[model samples]
Target: MNADLIIAGAGPAGLFSAVQAAENNENKKIIILEKNSSAGKKLLISGSGQCNLTHAGDISQFFDHYGENYNFLMGPLYTFDNHQLMKFFKDRGIKFRKARGGKIFPESNKASDILNVLLKEAKARGIKIIYNTPVENVKYKTGRFKIKTADKIYKSKYFLLAAGGKSFPRTGSTGDGFQIASSLGHNIIEPQPALAPVIIKNYQFKMLSGISLKNKEVSLWRKENLIKSWSGDLLLTHQGLSGPGIINYSRYMQKGDIIKVMLLNYSKEELENNLLKKIEREGKLNLLNLLIKFPIAQRLIEKILEIAEIDGSQNAAHLTRQERKEIIEIFSNLEFKIKSLANFNQSMVTKGGIDLSEINPQNMESRIISNFFAAGEVLDIDGDTGGYNLQAAFSTAFLAGSELKERL
Candidate 1:
């Protein structure tokens, strides 16, 4: 079989790219090969089935969520930003709602609705979609690309590898794109788990499993050096911590790293001053009662007191200065040793893939092979939770699709 463009993987990037490329040049024969039974398997599970389509904000603000490779996304995002993305869906009769932190979602709150829009658009463009047809190998020679699948060999003038990352193997994103790109001479970065939970060593907050703290400060420390800090809501799980705050920062963490959580809003000196004022104002009150005034849960406070070796029954007036300092330190800087990060099966996205340096940021075309392109998590571009990663996929795919004619 021959086509003007042969796109591997029918995920977000492949679907969007096929539709966009068809729209740009309707004369071209575009086909998308999907390994799964249907398209958008990963999309169906994104945002817990609600599907955070894109974030509503300035393009510059969206750049920060991508970390160090923020500049590489400038071209793609600016070309087809979140605003354009929302508009595309809205024009297709998809109603959207903006939730907290500017996350945009379909009003129906179903991921299937988002997939339906992409499928509808692709179908309208007369794009051929081959389901359950996984491409086994790809070869480029004489300016034509040959793709080998289970039943037959396919040829295309332009090839797009949008098979996604290895985060969710069950969804069919088993790092096949990485292997295909590597075979084509593109460098692949070591893929790691991202947007996943971290395990705590000997977790003391197990009793407070369901307790969730909002607007708390979580910091990552490596051997006494503060690496990074994030402020958001954190949930105390039975094994460790799991929440937007902890999961967002888990990308930079590893086993044996230190996670310091600030249970109180006040600084160390401010906390000590407040404790001293409490001792003076309520001298007859017990230590536990005095400590309960903070925003933290009572059980957590009790654990802190126990860790400090301070008797909760002791009156505030009877507490020594050393005991007061210990309490202050516990509240201002609670530390936990990280045991390990959740594996890819539980991760939202894969951290590493094809290194961004080897790809043309303007169009997402491979620097090593002309007419070969890539997008989505297959590249070394993972973002913080809240619709950032999906936007990257769309933006990069749009750019690559728009430039498909030039390569052809």
Candidate 2:
């Protein structure tokens, strides 16, 4: 098979790139080869099927989510930002809404709608999509690229390796792109699970599973030094913690690290002052009852008391100065020993892939090989949980697609 451009993997990046290429160069033949039976399998499950497409905020602030690789994406993100993304869908008659934390979602509340829009655009542009065709190997020589599938050798003027990262293996993102890029002289970073839940060592909060706290702060600490911290709603899982706040910081955590959860957003001094005020007003109230008066859940209050080795039935008046200080300390600095992070099966995205230094960030093309390009999680750039990663995929694909003819 011969085409102007052959894009591997029909996920968001590949599909978006095809659409862009087809729209810009009307006579160009664009083909997307997908390993899955259908396209957008992982996208369909994003945001629990609601599909948080992009974040709604200042374009400059978007760079902060990618950490050290922020500068590498500055060009792509500025070229096609979240506003342009929303406008692109809006122009196509796809209605969307902004939710809490600036998360943009389809107004219909279905991920299928987002996928359908991309599919509709690709169809309208006459882009060809081949399903269940995985590229086994990629070769580049004499300015033309040869992509080898199971039963065919497809040649293209330009190639895009968008097979995605190792996360969500069942969805077809099994790190195939890493090998393809590696074969072409691109450095592949050791892939690790990011945006995943963390298991606690001897988790005592199993009884508090299903309990969720809003506006709580979670901090990662290593050897008495604070590594990173995030503030958001937290969910207590059977094994440990799972929520935006925990998942956002899990990428930087390792085994034996400490997770400090601040149940209440209060300093030790503030908690002590509050406890003094409560004692003055409700001196006859039981210690457990006094704790339950706080904004925390009743089950968590019981658990905290249990950890502090305090009798819940004892009145606040019976508490000694040391016991009061301990109670205050627990509420301000609840700690959990890190057991391990959940594997790729449960991860939202992969942390590492094709190293950023191996690709031209401005055009999304391979630095070592001509006519070879990549985008999305296939690269080492992974963002936070709030639609930043998807935005990166779309932005990088846009830049790559726009530069296809120039690459040829």
Candidate 3:
């Protein structure tokens, strides 16, 4: 089999590129090869099936959401931004609703709606999607590309490797793109799980699994030095720590790194002074009762007391100065050592992929090999949660598709 352009994977990147390429130059014969039996398996489960397509804000804000490769994605994101992507779907009669943190989702709250629209558009433009066909190998020979599947070797004049990274292995994004791109002389940065929950060492909050803390600062530390910090809602899971606060920065975390959760918004001195004044005013009040008055959950305060080896039944008058100092320290800083990040199956995205140096950001084309392009998680780009990843995929796919007409 042969075509003008052969796109690997039918995720957001491949499907969006096929639609855009078909629209760019009619009768170009674009085809998308998907390993899954259907399209957008990962997408279908995104945002718990709500499919937050993009963020509802100025495109400039998107730059900070992507980590180190924000500079590389500037051109593509600027070209077809969140507004343009929203307009594209709105034009198809899809209604949208904005959720917290500027997350834009379909009003119907169904990820299938987003997938169905893309499929409809693809079908409308005669862009064929061949499912259950995973490319085993990719080769360029004599100005033509050869893609090998289990039973056949297909050829195309141009190729797009958007097979995605190994985040969800069951969803067909099992790092096939890395192997394919590596075979075609592209370097792949070793892929690791991103936006994954972390298992904590000696986690003492086992019973506090469902507890959530809002608007807290979580700082990452490497020994005596502070590495990085993020602020968001944090959840204590049965496994360990999770939520946007931890998961967003989990890419930079390694086993044995320490994470400090700022449970209280107070300095050591400030809390101590306030507690001293309160103890003076209410000397007979229970120490646990005094601590609970400072905007912390009762259960968390009790756990902290337990960890600090202080009896909650002790009155403020009976609380020794040493016990007071220990409680204050625990209240201000709760430290946990990371055991490990969740595996690829549990990760929301993959952190690293094909090295970005060989790919041109202008049109998502390979600088080393002409007519070979890539987009989405297959590259060394992972965005924070809340529609950034999907937006990156669409923007890069659009950039690739908009320039495919020139190659044709």
Q: Which ten residues in a row have the lowest lDDT in candidate 2?
A: 399-408
Ranking by TM-score: 3, 1, 2
lDDT of 2 by residue, 1-408 (tens): 999899998999999988877875667788999999999999999999999999999999998788677899999999999999989988988898889889999999898988998999999888999999999998988888999999999998799988999989999989999999899998888999999999999999998899998888878899999998878878999999988888876779899999888888789998899999998899799988988899999889998888888998999888899999998888888899999999999999999899899899889988898778898999998898889999999999998888885543
Give the winner by lDDT: 1 or 3: 3
lDDT by residue for model 3 (382-402), tens: 999999999999999999988
Better of 1 and 3 by TM-score: 3
Lowest lDDT block of 10, candidate 3: 20-29
Among residues 3 or more apart in sequence or in different chains, the pairs in candidate 2 whose N, CA or C atoms overlap within 3 Å are none
Best by lDDT: 3
| lDDT winner, 2 or 3 | 3
Per-residue C-alpha lDDT of model 1 across residues 1-408, encoded as one tens digit per residue: 999999998999999988888885767789999999999999999999999999888888988788677888999999999999989888999999999988999999999998999999998888999999998999999989999999999998799999999898999989899999999998888999998888899887788888888999888998888888889888889889889988877779989899888888899988888888888999899989987987778988887788778999989899998888888787888888999998899889998899899999999888888889998989999898999999999999999988885554
| CA lDDT scores, all candidates in order | 0.90, 0.89, 0.91
Give the Cα error of residue 388 in candidate 2, in Å: 1.3
